[model samples]
Each structure stands twice: as C-alpha cells, then as structure tokens.
Target: MQRKVDPEGLAAAAFLAFLATAGLFYVNIMAAIVDGLVSGLAFTDAQAGQVAAVNTYGAAFGAAVSIFTIARFDWRKTSILCLVILVAIDLLSILSTTPMTMIGIRTLHGLVGGLLIGTGMGVIGRTANPDRSFGMLLFVQFGLGGLGVMFLPRLVPLYGVAPLFLSLALFSLVTLCMMPFLPDYPPRSVAAPIKKAGTVQWTPLVLAISALFLFQAANMGLLAYIFRLGTESGLSRDMTSGALGLATWVALAGPLLVMVLGRRFGRFPLLLAGMLLTLGGNALFHWSQFGEVYLLANCATGITWGLVVPYLFGMTAEFDGTGRTAAAASVISKLGLASGPLVASMMLGGGAGFAELINTALAALVLAMLLMLPPAIMLDRSARRPSELLPQGKVTA
Candidate 1:
C-alpha cells in the first residue's frame, strides 16, 4: 500500500525539535548570557557563573528524570505544559532582585527546558530518519544561536537584562502557539520477547554514550577558552571575535551536509573523517601565532563540531526502539558540557599554558573517537548482515 506523506506534520516536528532544544543552544551562548547578568543585573561574575551552573545542573537532572518518563506520557501534552512553564519562568526571572532568586528561577526553567528537550529527542528517535531530524536540530540551533551570541549582548547595554529574559519568554510562547501542529508522538511498542530474553546490546550502547560524553567535553573545553587562546596567540580581540563569529556561520555547512547526504557513506566513515579533521584543527592551534592559521583552526573545528554531534545523537538513538537510550544520552551530554569548562578552569588555574590546554583537548578528542569506533563498526556490521541472518526483532538500520 502507498502511504500518504504529511508534509505539514514533518515540518511541525522539525520546528518543534528546533525550538525544544534551545536549552542546549543557550549553553552555546553562555558568554552573552553571563555578560547580561553581570552588566544588566549588576551581579558579580562569580554569582552569574553560579546561576549558569545551577541551571545546567538542573537541566541535566531533569533529563535524567525524563529517561524514565518518556514512554509513560503523551509527548504533545507534556511539551505544551513544559513550554507554558518555561515561559512563566522566563517572565518571573525578570522580577528577581537577588542572585539567589535569579538562580532559583533559572534552575526551574532549566528543569522544564530539559524535559522539553529530552521529549523532543525521544520523538526524533521514533522518526524514520533521526539523522536528518538531528541535523535539522543543529542547523536551527547554530543559525539562531549565532544571532543571539552576536546581538543579544548589545541589547543588555541599552535595555537592561529584561531583553534576555524577554527573548526566552517570547521563544517559548511562539513554540506554545505552534504546539497544536505537533503530532501526539505516542510511545512505540517494543518487542516483548526481546526484552524478556535480555537480548539488548549493552556494549555498543555504553561505548556510544561514552563517546558522546567525551566529544562534548572536549569541544566545550576548547570553546570555553578559545578567546583566550586566540589573544595569547598574537591575535587581536576584534580579530578573534570576528573569526569565531564567521566560523559559527560557516559551520552550518556541516549539518547541511548531513541533512543532504543522510547516511550515504555510513556513520563510521563520516565520524572517522570528522574526528580526523578535528584533530588537525586542534593541531593548527600550535601555529595560531599566524592570523590565518587561527582563523582556519576555528572554522575547521566549528564545522566538525556541527558535523559529529548530530551523528552521535543519531547513532545513540538507533540503539533502542523506545528512545530511552537517546534520553539517557541527552543527560550525558549535559553533564559533559557542564564539566568541560570546570576542567578547563582547573587547568588554567594550575598555571597550564594554552599549549597544554590544546594537548588536553586533543587527547580527549582522540579518546572520544576511539570510543565511538567500536560501536560504529558494530552497527556497520549489523547493517551489512541480511535480515534473515539477524535474530528476530533485532534488526537495525
């Protein structure tokens, strides 16, 4: 039988997935957010950092909770509730006078955002082409996030911190209005006998999760310090900032490739190539005293950053029909992101130079790529096997 395609449904799902993952993108723009708090709210740098940390920690915890609840609730209804609550929290944040109050409000906001994002990923896992969906997720995030990072801080100087909170509130409200367009995305039915027989492949799942964690940690660690690395490498602040911004916009090509190519070359080959480029990109930091090398390094790393993440998410999502694995991976991702800057801070505090920092990042990336290989190879092998040769109810693409 020929199936009718719901173009509107596909568009709505893609839009919601983009909106729902704003919490993760907010981390990508943490500098502007922290600066807004410091300049507009008159909070000290330490207090602003505390609020951001609390928010990230809260989101991670919320994603952990979602790992258990994804299959129990209606995704559309839950998403609507989360959006409403998030809007309310953002509105409430503007009224917070004390650092503690702001921290508390942002924590609540993060929890709701986390739930929304986790549910969104679960829905993506259920889709026929999660790689493309995840590619779209990164595409929207980088597109909007580049704008935010570039311009949001300018508003803080003129309009106070209200614009930051207002922007977030407005985004959630818009997503809420679009909620009616979303499919219900009810939980899928897993094969009961496979569950009973305990046939799940734990090894590859664990490896993939660990790989994602390391990938995030390595990238965030380098990103958190990229500005300093650039300046110390003899580049001016303006030049570094310009290069970073342009790199961000140029990085859109990576996800665009994923969306267009899908899995044409298989995950393992794509991942290996991406990681190799990442290694070369990091290595370029050694010659960053030359302005062109610095710019190229940032652009290279940025493109690979956009490339590997969605593929990793897509890989993890393939492990389970129920999407629980993807939810759990979201939690790991948040934790890794949160930990990255902390690790970087410790290294800098210990009097380590940028050279040492670059080495550490390179090591983490190498480890991440190694961790990803076994699972990618396993999935590749599974894909090549004939359907009849595989165990019943255990087929994967």
Candidate 2:
C-alpha cells in the first residue's frame, strides 16, 4: 500500500526537528554571541572565537557519537533529556566568570546540543521530503535569529549578557512544552543484509558531506567575524545589527524557494547559482566600509545561505534511506562550523585582515561548489523515478 504524507505529522516532525537543533541557535546569531562574550564578559576576540569553536568542536564530537545511536535511541526521551541539560547549561553560563570556565561549560552544552541536532537530522532524513523539512529548519533559524541579533545586543548593555543565556533557557522551556505534542518516532529498523547492500552509495554520500562542510566553514568563518568586520569598516553597532537582522528576515526567501521547488528543477543548478551568489556576497565584503554595500552583502549571502544548506542536506539524505548518511553529514557540518572560527581567529591573530578572511571564505565556497557537482549529478540522474525511496533497508540492483 502506498502511504500518504500526513500534513499534521509533517508539521509535528518539522517542529520537533527545529526544537532539537535549536540547541545550536547560537551559531545562527554568531555575531551577537561573539559580542555578548566580548562586551558582557570582557573576553578578547580570539578568546571569544576559541570559545565558540570549542563549543562546536564538542558538538562535532557529540554528533559523531550520535551517528552510532541515532537508529537505536528513542528520540522523544532523548530530546527531553538533552533539552533539560541544555537549559541547565545556559543558566550556568550566566555564572561563568572566566573564559576557561565558560568554554568548558559551553563545550558541554555543545555536546548535548550536537546529539539533539544529529538526531534531528535523522528525523528530517526520514521525512517524505527531506528538502522541505530542512527548508523549514532554516526558515525557523533565520526568523528567530533575526530577532536575536537585532535585540540581544541592545539588551546586553542593560542586563550584562544575562539575556543571552536567559533567552536560550527560555527557548528550551518552550520546546519542553511542545514535547508532549510530538508524535512517536521510533528507531529505523533494518535487516543486516540490506544495510550491507546500501554501501555502494557511500561515495556520493562522502562527496555531499564534503561539500556541506566546506560551504558551512566558509559561511561561518565570515559570520563569526561580521560584527568586527562592520565596526572595523567604520559602521556603527546599531547599523550592523539592523542590517544583519533584516538580512536574516529576508533570507527566508531562500528556503521558501527551496520548499516550493523541491527537486522539480534539480539540485546542481540551484546550488551553482546559490554558490555564485554566495561568492559574490563574500566579495562585496571587500567594500564593507560602505553601508549600502554592507547591507547588500549580508542580504545576498544570507539568502544564498538559506537556499544552499537544505539542498545539501537533501542531497545527502538521498544516498541512504535509513538517515545514517544525513546524521553523518550533520557531524561534518558541526566540524565545519567549529573549524571556521578557529581558522578566522588564527588569520586575524596572525595579522590578516578581514579581506584575507573573506577571500579565504570565497575560495572555500568555490571549492565546495566544485565538490558538489559529482554527487548532485549522480542524485539528479537517479531521481528520474516515480518518487523518492523510503527506508526499506535494501538497495535495488
């Protein structure tokens, strides 16, 4: 019997996936997170970046661990526990007096968050349309991230970064309330021989994961320093924050376009266009001294960001019906996020300017786009079928 997609189930699942990945929302509002640590906590720029990097590093580790457990664990219970721990960690962050202490606790927070997001990706991969599911994920991230970047900086001076941590705790609390409403998502069952047969798809999976990592690293490396980039270019804090917020809001178009199109037109064309736009956006940062240019650069990049990520995830999900590849891709994504800050911080510390950083990011994006081609081509060719495949645990010959 053919199964129909339940709209209500899709909504529930997308929301749950969002909540699960919400633990890493700090990355979406990277500028504000960096600022909060700097102004509110008095950490140096490099220290702040290091802290952010380690948090994601821990997340990468946790995500790697999740690849093993994603198909075995009860997602609802796991989400509940992770959210609870995340809330506790956020509250504890408020008490952090030193960078070392904050870094340690944040790493722990990242570990738990990574596990949640990895599991979330697994859920997304199981959906009727992984592309739409991932689009929803980006839509929510950009929406709330816009609000956070716009307002969090304003509150920081008045409340001393307390709002930052508190906001995270509040999000967790809200997610906790939404927990009971989530439908049960059991572990994917697979026959052992069928799993073995699926190994032929690993080559494409690896390529897709590589592309995602490079794209994320390139984007995040710039984002982690965008605030600094703006100020150094003589833009006011208010202007920078406003531009970021508005850009994020506008970025919704990217994901919306993805949802509307799905795989109708294929992946590489959109990815290629998006990547070129991203490259141009990064190039525009070379003119960040101009306000209009700064604003335009952010909007361009943010839109492409929203457009590209879902396709990448959807591409990875194509290789394996069991969601394991998607889960592994999540791990790589976190590693890329973790690496970006470290790389940016090093370049800055070694006397490299923002131009150098942006250029490096541009190069990464180009390479990432190139890496995406083979997998995108493979998936596009294979997709000439009645419909997408489900996790039946066996590969057809």
Candidate 3:
C-alpha cells in the first residue's frame, strides 16, 4: 500500500533540513564575511580561504561520525544539542583574533553543522518520496539563502561581520523551537535490512559518490572566490552581492522544475544537462568582463546546483536503504568542498586574476563531467533492466 503523506512531518523535515544545512547557506555569504575579516582583522586571502576550508573539513568529520552515531540517538535531541552548540560557537567566533583561532572555531562549528545536515538527510530519506522531500528542503534553503546574499553585503558594510555571526546564532535559536514536530527516527521499514544483503552491488554506488564529490568541489572552487572575481571584473560589492542574490533566486526554479516534472525525464539526462550548463557558466566567467555576464553565469550555475543535488542524494539513498551510504556520500562531498578553496588559494598564491580562478574551476568541472559519464550510463542501463524493477516500477540498481 502507498503510504499516507504526513503534512506536519514534511514541514518539520523541511524546516530542520534548512537549519541543519546552515553551513551551505553560510558559503553563499562567505565572501562578505571573508572581506570583513580581511578589513577588520588583517587576514590575508589565503587565511580567508583557510577559514572557509576548515569548516568543511570539520563537517566532513562530522558526517563520518554521523554514519556511525546517528542510528543511536534521537534526531530531535541531537539537532537541538547541535544547534545550541552552534549558537555558542558562533558567538565565540566574534572574539577570534587570528587566522588559527578563527580556523579552530569554524572547524568545531562545521562538526556540529555536519551532524545537523546528516540528520536532516536521514529524515528526508525516511519520507514517502526522497526526491520531492529533498526538493522542498533545497527550496527553503535557496529561498532564504538568496535573501541573505542580497542583504549581507549591505549589512557587513554597516554593522560589520559580527552581525552575520549573531544573525546565524539567532536563526538557530529560532529553529530550536520547531524540534518537537520532527520525527525521532525513520520508519521501521526504511531502517530494515535488505533481503539480498550480500548480493548488493557497490561499483555504481562508489562511482556516483565520487562523481558527486567532484561536482561539488568544482562548484565550491569557483564560489569561494566569487567576491574577488566580481571585484576584479569591476563590479562593486553591492553589485556582486546582488548578482549572487539574483542567481540564488533563479536557482529556486531548479528544484521546482524537478518537483513538477518528477521522473518524467530520467535523472541522468537532467544531471548531464545541469553539469553542461555549469561547465558553460564556468567558461563564461573565464571570458566575460561585464557584470551582467557574471550574473548570468551565476544564475546558470545556481540552477544547475539546485537540479543536481537532490538526484545525487536520491542516488545515495537508493544505493543504501539504511542511509549509511548517503551519510558517507555527504562526507565525501564535504571533504571536496573543504578542498576547493584550499586548492583555489594554492593556485592563486599571493594574487591571481579572475581568469586563473575560472580556469582552475573549469578543469575541475571537466574532470567531474568525465567521471560522471560512466555512472550515468550504468544507472540509465540499470533503470531499463526488467529484473531491476521494484513493485511501484521504481528502478533499484
């Protein structure tokens, strides 16, 4: 029998997913935060990159830990504790004077942030439709994230970076109030062992996860330097922020498009198209001197990101019914995210132009596209196999 949809459960899951993935949203406004640190605390470009990288490193660790520990605890309580810790940590970040200090604080923050995100993914995995649930989750994230990107530059100039940290803490505090509505654990069937345990395939799972990591790395590599790139292209801080905001708003169409279409088109086709769009966007950034071109590039990349993430998450869930593979995929993806800015910084050294950043990201995207193709073919073939069909006509590779 088809399961009944729980409206309240869906709402709680979407809200928690938004709050849990705060780190992802933080990245959207990170350029402003890095600028504030540079101006207020005398941080170098490399130091700023370190600050961004450390958080993702910590998040990778947290996600790994979640793979082992998430099944042991109640997600509601776990989320609350994580949020409380995040609030305290964000407040303490205000006192960080040196790059090392900031790195330590952000790394610790990422650990808890990763746990929240993993838990949220776990919740989404338990839903009637993981794809639609994740789509809603991203919708909330991008909608609010867009607003933050739009306003953060103005706020940073007027009130400095301290307000940004404080605002995040405040948001966490508000999200804490909604914990009562969320499920403590996934449904029993979702947590049950697979009937054909030892017969489970691993090759496609590894390929998909690897592809996701590369895709995210390429995306973040460029994103981490967006502010610098924009400024170098002769755009003002407000203009850059506005462009990102518009791009973020445009990204909303991605998940909504998926939700409405809902498997009418196969995942690989959409995934390939999104990847190509993102690659083209990266190329545009490399050649374009005008702010409008940059803004259009951001829009394309944002839309692609939105379209790709849910399917990636769904792939992981399909690979492992218990959600461990999804959690592991999160770890890999977070590590890639951590590495992106570090790699970009290394390429930049002391000072590099927007072209260099674009070139580096383009290379990463090309590699990701290549790696993704094999798995896309494998997944599409598996979907078409007669024996691989589930009861509802869903394909399980």
The TM-score obtained by model 1 is 0.79
Task: Give the CA lDDT, 0 to 100, for residue 274 in model 2.
Answer: 92
Could you estimate the TM-score for every candidate? Answer: 0.79, 0.87, 0.88
RMSD of 2: 4.8
Best prediction by lDDT:
2
Candidate 3 has a TM-score of 0.88
- Candidate 3 yields a Cα-based lDDT of 0.73
Candidate 2 residue runs with Cα over 4 Å from true position? 1-14, 70-73, 123-133, 187-204, 319-323, 381-397
Better of 2 and 3 by lDDT: 2
Q: Which residue window of length 10 is worst by lDDT in model 3? A: 388-397
**Alpha-carbon lDDT, every model:** 0.74, 0.81, 0.73
lDDT of 1 by residue, 192-222 (tens): 4343244446777788889999988888767
Clashing pairs in 3: none
Task: Tell me how far the alpha carbon of residue 65 in candidate 2 is from the true structure, in angstroms, after superposition.
Answer: 2.6
